[model samples]
Target: MVFGFLKKRRREEIRAQPFPAEWLAIIERNVPMYARLSEADRDELLRRVLVFVDEKNFEGAGGLEMTDEVRVTIAAQACILLLRLDDDDYYPALKSIVVYPAAYTVPRKESEGGIVREDDAVHLGESWGHGAVVLSWTSARRGAADPRDGKNVILHEFAHQLDQEDGAADGTPELDRLAFYAPWARVLSEHYLALRTAARTGRKTLLDQYGATNEAEFFAVASECFFERPVQLRTRHPELYDELARYYGQDPAEGSASA
Candidate 1:
């Protein structure tokens, strides 16, 4: 017990260190919205991000070197998700982040009836429950330029980490003591169905139809939209807005909107 206590203490001490000013400035320069965070909040995010970068294993793809710029670019976006929430909890499950130079082929091998073949799948980003986040530098940078479009690779995958917390990305997590799961169910269900309908009808949707794939994707995609474009989401789907507001303990429209 004493050993465990000391280990936890050390973790907290690591989490309290100051992030380099130059690193903070780099993120702020690339991601304008990152500048909006309050000084204290900035410090806290830096603290977590600093440790997050160090703790994770990052490898370069296509000959790109792993540099502070690359890690900070990705960490800053991941930090966005943690800005309003505690750094502990579900996301702690992720221990490593692998960054590629650009979208690359993730090959999967399979056999059919007595034959075997390998298929190369092209991907920009992928998150695994085994505690790794794989991202493309190009896609990551694009997501940084504008967090309002809901296509943030970091936010999308991190939201999946949140969804996977309760052992499955089933579009739900452990809520606060006062959280109302019923409303969450109702709102998410409605929007999810709407997204499905749009996909079925081949119509463009406010929330990406990728959300229609499953309950978990719906939750993650909705989270991207929730933080990225809350006003639009709330105006179009007020019920979902209310539900997410209660769920995340945030009114993103408060911090991100221009009145």
Candidate 2:
């Protein structure tokens, strides 16, 4: 009971702050899906965003200056994933968000059966197991601007954070019920294999071919497609889409005509 009261008090305190008009304008102009939410969901999202901005540290990288626009933009997208979630402990492990001015190059290591190769590669975003998410500001803004492209770096990275909540990024997040895990594993495994085949055969698929790289990447890329291309995902991969819809508790396609 004490914990519940504290949580409620914290939420009330966060919600008591005035949501900036400019931030609301940013959401209105940038996040297309924000306009599709019902009034109640929108209010909830705003509350979550407020709490998220209060909790997470935002740091600028590569000569970028963190601003309210950047913070709120990223927070709103991250909170979108939490909108229908049951708990308010949004990303308990995520503590910091690092934003770069543009696509940043990072050192990469590849191992194929004990042969190791090192190189530098440009990436839009990355999520770390130790509770930090790195994103390219340009990609993040563009992703918010165009919501139906099925290529949201913010969603993709935050999905990785969710995948890591269980201390591993194995494509399966913590589920509400034990039984839900069985179907989640079954459906995602089937689709992951199909994506691998599609990637090898050079066949077009609803999900990004990057998903075929690994199970963890599959979940992240699938999450991007789930939110950004829901109707198409539902049409092409109904069972996989159903699993995601069940977990998220929101049918974005049903809410948006364009989706």
Best prediction by lDDT: 2
Clashes counted in candidate 2 amount to 0
Note each model's CA RMSD in angstroms. Answer: 2.7, 2.0
In model 2, which range of ten residues has the least summed lDDT?
A: 250-259
lDDT of 1 by residue, 1-259 (tens): 9976875676688787766888877787777656556667667777778766766677887777899888888877777777766546327688878888899898889999999999898998888988888888898888878867867777888888877776877898656654577778878898899899999999988898899999988988898898788888889999998878876766778666642
Model 2 residue 240 CA deviation in Å: 0.8
Clashing pairs in 1: none
Sequence-dependent TM-score of model 1: 0.88
Angstrom error of the Cα, residue 252, model 2: value is 0.5
- Kindly report which residue stretches of model 1 are placed more than 4 angstroms away from their true locations once superposed: 87-90, 108-118
The TM-score values for the models, in the order shown, are 0.88, 0.94
Residue 152 Cα positional deviation in candidate 2, in Å, after optimal superposition: 0.2
The lDDT values for all models are 0.79, 0.91
lDDT for each residue of candidate 2 in 1-259, tens digit (9 for 90 to 100)? 9988998898889988888899999888888879888889999899889999988999999999999989999999999998888756789898999999999999999999999999999989999999899999999999888888899999999999888998988999888899999999999999999999989999998899999999999999999999988888989899999999988888888877643
Clashing pairs in 2: none
